[model samples]
Target: YILRGWIEDRSADEARGLDRAGWATALTDPAVGTALEAVHDEPGRAWTVEELGARGGLSRSAFARRFTALVGMPPLTYLTWWRMTSAGRLLLSGDAPLSAVAQQVGYVSEFAFAKAFKREYGIAPGRYRRVENARAAS
Candidate 1:
C-alpha cells in the first residue's frame, strides 16, 4: 500500500515533467519497457547490449536503434549514466567505502570506477562525497 502510493506519486510527478531522470517516456513501448525495467531492477549487473536486446526480444542492431530513438541515448550509455547516478546517490547518502560503492554499481575495479565517475561527474567520487556532505551539513 505504501509502496503503491509512492509509485503512484512518482508516476504523477513524471507526468507533470517533474522527474529529471526522463525514464518514464521509454516505458510506453513494451519492448523498450522490458529492457528498461531490467536495467532499473539490476543496475549493478554487467549488461551487454546483445543481452538487453534479447530481453526485449529484439536483435542487437534493431534494439540499439529503437532504444536510442526512444531513450535519446544508446543502451550502454544509459547503463553507464545509471551506474554513475546510483554511485552519486550512494556517495551522498551513505558512509560506504569507495570500493564498496564501486562494486555495488558494477565496477569491479576501484580505480576504473573512480575514473569513470570522474569522467561522468567531472570530480572524483571521494571529493564529491565530501563536498556533498559538507553542503548538507551547512
Candidate 2:
C-alpha cells in the first residue's frame, strides 16, 4: 500500500501540471501506467480500484469502463494479476519468511497466501523459491 500510495501521490503531483489539452491526448495517461506498476507490486491491495479511479478524478463506474477499454482488463482483474505477480517476486526473492512475505503482499494468512501462491505458480511457495534459486545458481 505504501508503494501504491507513493505512485498515486507522485502521479497527482505530475498531473497537477498537465492541462486539459494534454489529457485530450490520452483517455488514460501516464499516471495510470505508474499506478498499474504499483499494482504490480501488490495486486491484493483491494483499494486499488477506488484508489486508481480517484487518481484520475473519476467515479468508480466511469473508471471501470475506461480502464477496461484502455487496459483491456477490468481494474479488479488487474489487481489480482498484480497481487499474484508480486507474490511470485517475493517467493523467488528468498529474502523473507513466507508469512512475512504474505503480509507484506497483503495476505493476512500464511495458508491463504500459500493457496493463492500455488494457484499462481503451480507449486508451494517455499519449494518454488528453492527450485528457482537452485536453477539460477546452476
Candidate 3:
C-alpha cells in the first residue's frame, strides 16, 4: 500500500513529494530492502545523482560512492534497469499498441521504445507481445 502510494505520487510528476516515500526512506541509512522499495515505487522516471544526493543529504560524489557500495550500481544504471523492467511488464500485460505502451513508459516514440525494449529483452516488442498473447491463450 505504501509502495503503491509512492508510485502513484511519483508518476504524477511530483518527484519531491516522492522523495519521502517508502522506497526513498532508507537511502542514506542504506537498508537494502528500502533501497529496492524506492526502485519499486518509481521504476520509469529518470533520477540524477545530484537529486538523489540531496535527498540523501550528502555531496554528489559521496552519494555516488556510497550508493555504489550499497546498491552495487550507479543511480542511472539502476534507473534504466528499473525503467526497462516496468516497460517489460506493461508490454506483457497491456493490449495497448506498442506506441501507447512506449508513451506510458516515458519514451517519446514507438521506434525508440521498441529499440530499448529489444535491447533489454533480446526480442522485438511485437514478437514478445505475440508470444505473451499465445501463452495466455493456453
The lDDT values for all models are: 0.82, 0.66, 0.65
Q: List clashing residue pairs in candidate 2.
A: 43-83
Over 1-138, each residue of candidate 3 has an lDDT whose tens digit, in order, gives 444644554653342233343336344364334445565676544556776677656777887776666655676665665666677677777788888778766677889888988987789988998888889899
For candidate 2, the C-alpha RMSD (Å) to the true structure equals 9.1
Best candidate per lDDT, number?
1
The digit string of per-residue lDDT tens for model 1 on 34-118 reads 8887887788899999999998899999999988878768899878977887788889888999999999999999999999999
Give all TM-scores, in the order shown.
0.83, 0.67, 0.66
Quick one: ranking by lDDT, best first? Answer: 1, 2, 3
Q: Quote the positional error of residue 9 for candidate 3 in Å.
A: 24
Worst lDDT window (10 residues) for model 1?
1-10
Off by over 4 Å in 1: 1-23
lDDT of 2: 0.66
Off by over 4 Å in 2: 1-31, 37-44
| lDDT tens digits by residue: candidate 2, 1-138 | 544543544454355442333323333465455456556554556565678877777778877777666655687865654566567666776678989878877788999989987886689988888989899899
**Clash number for model 1?**
0
| Top of the candidates by TM-score | 1
What's the candidate order when arranged by decreasing TM-score? 1, 2, 3
